[model samples]
Target: MDWDDMRVFLALARVASLGRAGQVLKMDPATVGRRVSRLEGHLGRRLFHRSHQGYALTEDGLRLLPHVEAAQAHLSAAETPNDTGAGLSGQIRLGAPDGCANYLLPQVIARICADHPALEVQIVALPRLFNLSRREADMAISVSAPQAGRLHVQKITDYHLHFAAAASYLDRHPPIRQIADLRGHSLIGYIPDMIFDKELDYLANLDLHAARMTSNSVPVQLNLLRQGTGLGVVHDFALPHAQDLRRVLVPVFSLTRAFHLVRHADDLRNARLRRFAEALIVGLRDQVARLEQAVAQADDQANSENP
Candidate 1:
């Protein structure tokens, strides 16, 4: 019945390892084990199926999770009376695709850190799904909108990508005035089968056979492009950093995808999380003009050619 015991229970359930939970809670492993045992005793039921592999939540534990999370959210809301989020301070783990993590987030996070000196932001730049239900990340910027889950989703921005090649590479290769010219060029792209998210299947709609050189990491692909390895789809936002890269095929070969901001529904009431979400939304909105400029460059090129 103690909130402190429930906190221990939540921590253990999240990590599935007493040592890890203790690390998170800043308690000794033995103390964490004792607290879990006490909570189990008070409830008159085994919450975790203990094994060498680690703790697995029982059905009762799973059932209790939602209620506990709700209580935690309400408690957090109660403690932070200033809903404006100016006084918010806590760690926020954000999972984002490599491109956003590397190029987009640094400035946004830097500003957030300056605004709230007490807040810490951790960026996980993996190209895969972030499991919000399991608390893998407090929030995520995803390539695709989640179809179904206990999640809150918002469209962060619509960003564009175009087939690009290093100016040096283009100088050596046959001129590419059209999409068909790409066939004669060495293409750099994602390894088809290794793409975890359907949204990342950039080559699928291109009708291209396969890449001459491929990498799963977007940054790696960009590096390959920078090295003049071949033509590859590059994000518009990334162009600011890679000035040597030239947009090829003009307006004819381009892709636009939406970035979504997602978080667990239960954490919606937590002031710190809410504040970060607001900051993200505002920051991304402010970059809309710059984000769209890459696509506009292609249009300019096309118009010049036609004229």
Candidate 2:
């Protein structure tokens, strides 16, 4: 089997579309389809089930994938020299919850790409968990690590959050001496059913419910806070973007969560992915530490001035 054909097959399997695979390979769609056809003829197994939903992988294809992925990993490793002089080149897609994607990954990825000009990074920020098994993304940052699956997980960093609101909203509202006062304010937070992970259920820790304003996206929630719509749990790292927002019940309420770096098991053998993962882990730790410190210092300054 031609290695080039195997690449086309993998690309088609991943994206589930001829045009998308072709674009990734910089080849014509017809050429991509032809390559898949040739590979099927060579292997004597129909790899994909073609339909309106695009090319869904067949049972045979599913069985063949891990072997092919292993082979590809080996090939990629062999291509890397002992000195590793070449700049990291290739696309690395990361699936993350919007909080990290919006507040953290941009700056971290910026530095990564700056150091390696050839590298390309794509961040998919969604409220739901990513299916890394299906190659939804090469890597994922999750609130909690998974216990099952042929995968690798690493704890990136633990970050903090607090019940926070814009200064304008705070000034206009009744003083919040304790959690009980929250009942009088418009609570902005995730839609109850839309909380994808147990860790994302921020209000539950405080025995609170019924957010008058809700969204699945973190940025949307943050925007609601920025607009003085209401006070809600906000990540400390996200505070830089909304400097006007201030923590409420800081002495009484706080949430700590960690970000986990997850990747496919087979990626352990791929030198390029390993390098990218290392850089990503380091960058995330640094960014979280740096952002949290800045927030703490600002909080201190605010309190000192008021006192």
Candidate 3:
């Protein structure tokens, strides 16, 4: 019944191990165990099933999760926003793909930290999977369109990707006269089947013979491009700032991807997520112009080569 008890429950549920959960909450394992046991006693239902590996949510726990999370979100929002009192002070968990974490987050994180000094932002970076339903992250940045969910979704922008390589790498490869020519040269790409969606998987299947290396990690892929490993597909958002690489437009076929921002249905009403979503949307809108310019430049470069 106590709010702190519910907080402990949520943390424990997420971390899946009493020891790990206690570490997160700065509590001893025994204290965490006692609090969870107390919570279960109050509810008259077992919340977790313990095993050698870790704890798994029981049917009762699954039923209570949404309500518990909603209560916590609302409680956080109940704080007065006025500057005369203590401001919002809690952690916000964000989920992003490895690529976004590496390329897009640092500036936004710096800005968010500067504006809300009391707010703590924790990023859960994964190669491709982040479970918004389990509250792995309150907000997610995704490459594909948002799937079926009650969550509020926003399409940040449609981003174009380009085949790029180190300038030196291009100098040695056969001239990219057309898309067909890509079949003959070695290229680098994302690790095969690393992305989840069917469309992305199909795109990865494209035989860019020039691919000599591939990886699921975007930073690693980018580093390979910089090292002149081979031609690779990269987003312009991550490309414009690259000083060492040149964008190579594959004539006849160009790949564009959309970026979306997603939040859970319950968290949309929370104070922290609402404000953070607004700032992120604003930042994305501001970046749209720059994104379009990059696309146009890539097209222009491609046209010049063909003409």
Backbone Cα, N, C clashes tallied per candidate: 0, 0, 8
- In angstroms, how far off is 122's CA in candidate 3? 1.3
The most accurate candidate by TM-score is: 2
lDDT of each: 0.83, 0.89, 0.74
Q: List the candidates ranked by lDDT, beginning with the highest.
A: 2, 1, 3
lDDT score, candidate 3, position 246: 76
State the lDDT of candidate 1 residue by residue for 31-72, as single tens digits: 999998999999998888899999988888888877898999
Off by over 4 Å in 1: 13-24, 44-60, 81-84, 291-307
Assess every candidate by TM-score: 0.87, 0.95, 0.83
lDDT of each residue in 181-204, candidate 3, tens digit only: 677566676666566655354245
lDDT of 2 at 63: 82
Candidate 2 residue lDDT tens string, 169-288: 999988897998888688999999988999988887565658999999899999999998888999999999889999989898888999999999988888898899999999999999
lDDT at position 138, candidate 3:
73
